[model samples]
Target: MPGVDHCLQEAMAIPGAVGASIVDYTTGFPVATTGAAPNSDHEAAAAGTADVIQAANSRSLFVSAMPHDLLEDLIITTAGGYHLLRMVQTEFDSRLVLYVWLDRVQGNLAVARRRMQKLADELVAT
Candidate 1:
């Protein structure tokens, strides 16, 4: 398994990748990051994205339908680019998220998502 640093490096290597970070949602802290910094302030972006994840996870309409399903990931596509958030289950923490910002014109959403999922699966905290 790749450690957090290695995982972040691999994430940044993805085509059209603008930024990437591993966030601990419970505390709104980023465990690792690379490429462009979100919002010129990674801390703020980490906090904000944590809120996004929490909001998505709490929706009764979605969660009620699959009570046993843990959130896998969340994607937000904009006119200019895409924000992909992949959840990583950890033995040491209750919540972790891999967030990557990609350029829409150059990125393949399907490929990025698949690679992100694979990275999440191989990620291990160091």
Candidate 2:
């Protein structure tokens, strides 16, 4: 099983990955990080990520009609790149997210999403 640092390294290995981090959405704090961050500020980026997640979780529009359904991931596209957020599903109630930033022109959204899903799935084994 991979630890946080190793998981992040794997995340950065993805094509066009600009930055990657594991964040505690509940506190808007970064648990681990690698590569370049937006605005050269990982803290701000994490907080902003948390805010977006909090909004989605709280809003009924984002919710599903199925009682067992849960939010899995979110992809936000920008003029410069793609912001990917994969909710880490743990055995407990802890709120966590795997965040990845990729260059829009160089990154393959389909590939990145698939890789993020795999990474998130493995985290539970740690």
Candidate 3:
């Protein structure tokens, strides 16, 4: 399996990929990150994402609906880029996530998502 850095590099190799990071959802901490803009603040981004996920989950429960067996993945598209967030279901209570940013002009959302799914399978927590 590839290391975390190598995994992020491979993600960037995908057409239109701009940045990628492996994050820990429980604490909203980044295990590794790559290709963000010069002034991007990854820590803040991760924390915010975690909060978003938690809110979504809570909303589902409040609606009297069970959450998806698992979150599997999430995608957000903006005027400038596409953000892909995938939760990695490891063997413990702790969960991990892959956060990716793709340039909309060049990115193929389907392909990027497929590549991220494959990479997540190969990533192992140490």
Candidate 4:
């Protein structure tokens, strides 16, 4: 299985990829990170992203009826880049997510999504 660093490296290689982080959704903490912008707070972003996911799930009526299945993925677009979040489902209750930032001018969203999915599958947590 690919390690977390390897996974982040592969993500950075993607067209338009600027930064990436592997996060623990349960604790809203980053397990690994790469290519953060100068002066950017990656930890805060990871925590905020987790909060957004939790808030969305909690506030959605449809989600309330279903079992507490982890969120699979999320995508957000900004003026400069795209943010892609992919959740890794594990046997344990803890869920992991990959947070990727890609430049809008250079990134291929479709390819990034596919690669993130593959990477998520290959990751083996120790």
Which residue segments of model 4 deviate by more than 4 Å? 37-39, 62-70, 124-126
Candidate number achieving the greatest lDDT relative to the actual structure:
2
lDDT of 2 by residue, 1-126 (tens): 788888899999999999999999999999888998999999999999999998888875756657868889999999999999999999988899999999999999999999999998988865
Model 1 has an lDDT value of: 0.87
lDDT of residue 66 for candidate 2 = 77
Q: What would the per-residue lDDT of candidate 1 be over residues 13-119, giving only the tens digit for each residue?
A: 88889999999898889888887866678888899889998888885467446657778889999899999999998787468899999999998899999999989
- TM-scores for the candidates: 0.91, 0.95, 0.85, 0.85
Query: What are the clash counts of all predictions, listed in order?
Result: 0, 0, 0, 0
Q: What is the lDDT of residue 123 in candidate 2?
A: 80
Which run of 10 residues does model 3 get worst, by summed lDDT? 59-68
Which candidate order results from sorting by lDDT in descending order? 2, 1, 4, 3
Residues 6-108 of candidate 3 have per-residue lDDT tens digits of 8899988989988888888778888888888314888888887777667665555543355446567888898888889887767867668898889999998
Error of 2 at 29 (Å): 0.4
Predicted structure 1, TM vs. truth:
0.91
Query: What CA RMSD would candidate 4 show?
Result: 2.5
Candidate 3 positional error at 30, Å = 1.1
RMSD of 3: 2.8
Give a tens-digit lDDT track for model 4, residues 1-126. Answer: 577799899989988899999888767898898998424988888888788677766676655475776467888888888899887877677667888999999998999999999888888544
lDDT of each: 0.87, 0.92, 0.80, 0.82
The TM-score obtained by model 4 is 0.85
* Model 1: residues with Cα > 4 Å off, grouped in runs: none
